[model samples]
Target: MTNIQVLDNPTMHNLLINLSKEESFTFREIIEHTLESFSVNGERQYQPPPSIVNRPNGQNTLFRPFTSDTCIGTKITVESGPDGQGRKSPPHGVIVLTDSKGNPTGLLSSNEITGYRTSMNAFRFLGERMWIIL
Candidate 1:
């Protein structure tokens, strides 16, 4: 099945709809884990303060004009899988986070969001079939 066909079919469309939801939830989880894993110690902490407040020379004014937040952006790609014609296809993508300077902070190529979405869709479908709606 081709990616274009996957986007065209109604069943696939529904699956994709749920897949997107799952991917979003999974991506949030991944970000939470990453944030939990991060630490600020010694130079790392002082290197870039979470927020910077500065006062202009000759002006008795304090201002916090710089702040930063972090998140992981996920993107998916499909390359003619194994058979070359996409008779059987697979997905490839990665997750990356940008630093305050807009540079890549980490490279996570697990395709975890895709796998989570696929598995959740199939599991839900099967559970419905088995009347185990949990």
Candidate 2:
């Protein structure tokens, strides 16, 4: 049993904002971090394919595990289908962070991070091909 610091949406957002200010983080840092992971000379870690489970309540849960040299963790998200009125439920998730020794450290809400990562990837792709588009 490991003690995990669970961070909710507001807390996660505040932490990210604080961190960005303290470290002067920018979108370029996101792209660099992603590129570094896939570099030819960088150490590649094993990331098993995500597993999805469909519940009886019309909700699907996805569990994705990833590993790096310093840490490993899993992201679990639940997607609820449309309701009786055809209104879709917003997806929610948490990401568990663990140290190299497999000790759980923190559990963060994944909504913000997911959106940020997605947008960053899209920006990276477009930035790399801006000349062709222009």
Candidate with best lDDT? 2
lDDT against the true structure, per candidate, is 0.43, 0.78
At residue 59, candidate 1 shows an lDDT of 18
**Colliding pairs, model 2:** none
| Top TM-score prediction, candidate number | 2
Q: Compose the digit string of candidate 2's lDDT tens values, residues 1-134.
A: 45778889998677656655425347557646854774533444466678999987688999988787788888999999778987778999999999899988988999977876676677667877996788
lDDT of 1: 0.43
RMSD of each: 18.1, 3.6
True-vs-predicted CA distance for residue 89, candidate 2, Å: 0.7
